[model samples]
Target: MRLSLKVWRQSNKEAAGGFEDYKLDNVSPDMSFLEMFDVLNEQLIEEGKEPVAFDHDCREGICGMCSMYINGRPHGPLRGVTTCQLHMRSFKDGDTIVVEPWRAQAFPVIKDLVVDRDAFDRVISAGGFISVNTGNAQDANSLPVPKEAADDAFAAAACIGCGACVAACKNASAMLFVSAKISQLALLPQGQAERSIRAEKMVAQMDAEGFGACTNTGACSAECPKEISLENIARMNREYIGAKFSSSAV
Candidate 1:
């Protein structure tokens, strides 16, 4: 259960960074990837060395904060699994693992294995919402949307903005994330009011954030934890084109 870890070490965004090797002994195959990191950090602290800096808000994988590039794959080698949920058993004994942060210009390195993802916040702030003045509460079944649309909306809404989409893309595109958000609204009755405007504003903001364009590589959906489909990207394109042609967001 022992292995060598080659982890990225960077003091700050401007600082030069490189991989530092460490030997992890007495490791348990049952341990989660983040738990293995905790063991490593404890050992480093005992030796009066600064522990590797990584993000993990909820180690249970619900918060999407446990973002990392494990052995060149976002959230480790497993499909549809976040780093916090990745189990050490996935790797063989005596394996050499390379860990790093999400590599993208928009997602700058905040420290070792931690990148600033506030660009996602900026995109969300750019009209990823509805504006109708519906005075709050309504009947439970008042506006029954079609079941298929509801399912599609729910599927698209599952995106957690982990940026695995960007990390997996050759050009580091955020289209999957953006398109997921756009499709979530475009497929639902509640989101209809702001659909067109939302698509336009979010797309503009995504470009402003310096994210690369989608080239149909399909890597983003493959790496996505929620398995956000590429169909959402197509839906977003349709929404954006339709919005540009319309005078109003109707």
Candidate 2:
């Protein structure tokens, strides 16, 4: 397939950025999106031009590092898939594809299509883990988790921190990502000890990181590669309110 790419180019976070155009020919339909970029890079290198820079690792989609905005959508037009998992066949021949990095204050561009997502790490660090001593691995049957709760927790835990939620939201909210992390731990028995403070701290950290408030437009979940439910956001709000009330009562 032949294609035209309009990709964002930035030297660093403080550098002014804009789109640069390139044309690619003889692209294979079976090639992963990154592979197509690789081909483009090869051509650029052979022509003595600087190659496009994009983040990618574990191209099978597990890493969530391939965080590109393709044609105005996070990870292209596909559902439940990351940019690394997106295939060239998803596009038509002679199509013009617009690619950009995650456009959020919290995710400032480093260069080209790469953005600094360390803000997510900071949010998780605030209160996304269970500090209690649960000891070594116990028998699965020893603590029988309710089927529904376990399923829901696992679903929430599937979030890959890709920042698509931020990119998808006009407000650049990290609520969906933060909520998923909170929900995953809050739904499990092991996470109960920290539950009260977890929601408050993480939400506070998210705000400190400059992420915007949830728009209530549901764009985050719709573009989420993991399909993390919007319900997690509601759960997080309840947890936060409950935590605040309990703290004030003391």
Q: Which regions of candidate 1 deviate over 4 angstroms?
A: 132-136
lDDT of 1 by residue, 1-250 (tens): 9899999999999999999999999899999999999999999999899999999987776687889898888998888888989999999999999999999989999999999999998998997877666587777699889899999999999998889999999998899999998888888787887777788999999999999999998989988888899999999988898899983644
Off by over 4 Å in 2: 132-135, 248-250
User: Candidate 2 lDDT, tens digit per residue, 96-122?
Assistant: 999999999999899999999999999
The C-alpha local distance difference test score for the whole of candidate 1 amounts to 0.90
lDDT of 2: 0.93
How many collisions per candidate? 0, 0
Q: Candidate 2 has which clashing residue pairs, if any?
A: none
TM-score of 2: 0.96
All candidates' lDDT scores? 0.90, 0.93
